[model samples]
Target: MTATYAEHSARKRRPLFRRRSAIPGFAVTMGVTITILSLIVLIPLTAVALKAAQQSSSEFLNAAFNERALMAYRLSFGAAFIAATINGVFGLLTAWALVRYEFPLKSLVNGLIDLPFALPTAVAGIALATLYAPNGWIGALVAPAKVAYTPLGVVVALTFIGLPFVVRTLEPVMRDLAADVEEAAASLGASRFDVIARVILPALGPAWLTGFALAFARAVGEYGSVIFIAGNMPYKSEIAPLLIIIELEQYDYAGAATIAVVMLVVSFAMLFVINAVQAWARRLSA
Candidate 1:
């Protein structure tokens, strides 16, 4: 009987919960997780939704989709998309270079990639505004092109803040990608471009998309860094967050909430689509 029982135990799958776990059980862990999530995220979002719901449909639409609001949305989303795309391309190159080669000041450059994350957004905005102002060094060199106090400045700021997201996301994946795969592809008579397209890009697509989505989302909500450079001109360089602040300044709480809800929904929808695409890419790569 003992021999038979031992054989059966060995063949059985391991249970998720061990008889003697060091940590708490599933029920306690799940309860704590849910409670924390509710406190940090769900509760505030629910409040925003409820506040927006106080307004009638017409009022909500008027505040959320006004002409100025629409323009702000366009500028914010457009600049964010452009910046995220730029980051995706250059970030991939940066990651590849960092991983595949060694150069002077490599560590310094790698450390600098995370500067945007550690730097305060307001300080970043101020610094960028100063550097890109018409009389500033870089701005003077550009001559005829204006950067600060323009929509282009918004893109510049967004790109600056978003680059770290893409670079950090790609670096680990790039490092994990074995050189053997590329050599194998080359050995199979594939061209350099073919090796990249066939082996590297396919492996990196999902992660790239995830990084792009994160950058886009971050750029869309960015305020302090953009405002100084953007000049915050109405219907021109103004962003959605600035618009929300404007509404709030006038003590239009419901209107502000309505705009917030619109932004929330749009951001959520875009993220959902990006996540779906990422999932599709993963399946295709698999």
Candidate 2:
């Protein structure tokens, strides 16, 4: 009786959520994670900044802001933005269909969407270049459209690379969403479009923005596939990352770093804005 009473007393003393392990183990995990991140990310980033610091601020600006570099920047950001926008619109529809509809080969279709993730960037670029080039098999048909070796080709390459980010981001969110909300809307005489526009889209706002941000960032850094199709035409098809590589090859490390810093800053700002939009969306949902 006394032992059972003691056991009961112990149970009563335990908190609702007791610690499974009292060992202070996050210290090692934190140290290792931080060290790995610093080595891979912070160290390299710091090196770029340090190399650029070797030059005068005006020199760095002049090198990175020259007409060629500026044109590359324009092409890179412009193509990425257009690609991300396209991904956002179509990815949402794809996610909706996967979650809310059933059809033959649905699983196969889902698998195909992720093929880009497994394919080598070099291989993807080569294939796209061949597919879209003026006189190649598929290109022979489309060359009339003048799609390859032009700015349009860069957008296509970026769009191909960024599609998975959007679809994957929205898929889980759509799956976990309760059918009751839509049901409730329908029950209250709300049309399908109204339910989706007012009830669903608002809930999905943050995740959609997050997906767009990811796609945007990924597209901005893309080089392999774009290089093959872009023709690297100065001021026309060259992208910012390729321009930075050119600067580095020419022994202009400071110029490359300056451009790198600009890309980093702009990407960071974009991600920050996305995060803010997410916060606002959460508040709205609440």
Candidate 3:
């Protein structure tokens, strides 16, 4: 009997020792991940760099930094920055309202927040252009403001698409925040403004930065939606991506590559700085 019991116990222990994880081994998984990343991301970026390098340094500089390119860059980066700032402020308010308050049609409103994501960029552009045309409904209401076919319209289009990034990034963080903390602050004689400024903002600072960075990045690369509204006027409302397409259309691949390289470098640098700041904020909040 003792031998029988011992054999059964050993069978159970053997299965425990023999069981394997469902995932592949780390080496295999890591190798596959690196191979995929190289194929999809690294190789294309390298090709772009090499293509741009085909041009002489002066040629590259002229292509990337000429009057037309500079104007386009200014508009693209400036509009993206402004749009991201707007999204950051209003996205916070929207997320806060969703998480902290009860309202009629709450579910419908929450669902609508993701409308931009499901909507195609071209469709969104056309819809926005029609709605904001000087003769259109909302445009007629704000007559003489000149929304569509201007730099302002570019900002508006960017803000429309980028808002979802900020709001979604903030929603999870806002939900994680405990109401007890606010109650505790209130019970201790802190006013509503004081509670928000001192208690809520600190906890959300990192997430806010992350959301702002995401929105800015999305807006920087936007093309289809912005082109429809911006009117693509050179030195006026043209954006950097539009310049890239124009270069391609003119059969100036090297010039297009140079412009792309410049945008890529600037965008990467900005995102790196934003991420660093986000990390610092996280450390401080911790």
Q: Tell me the lDDT of model 2 at 277.
A: 83
State every prediction's TM-score relative to the real structure: 0.94, 0.90, 0.92
Pairs of residues clashing in candidate 2: none
What are the lDDT figures for the candidates, one per model? 0.94, 0.91, 0.94
Mind sharing the TM-score for model 3?
A: 0.92
In candidate 3, the residue pairs with backbone N, CA or C atoms under 3 Å apart (3 or more residues apart, or in different chains) clash, namely: none
Identify the runs in model 3 with alpha carbons over 4 angstroms from their true place.
1-19
Candidate 1 residue runs with Cα over 4 Å from true position: 1-22
Candidate 2 whole-model C-alpha lDDT, 0 to 1: 0.91
- Give the lDDT of residue 263 in candidate 1: 88
- Candidates 1 and 2, the one with greater TM-score: 1
Clashing pairs in 1: none
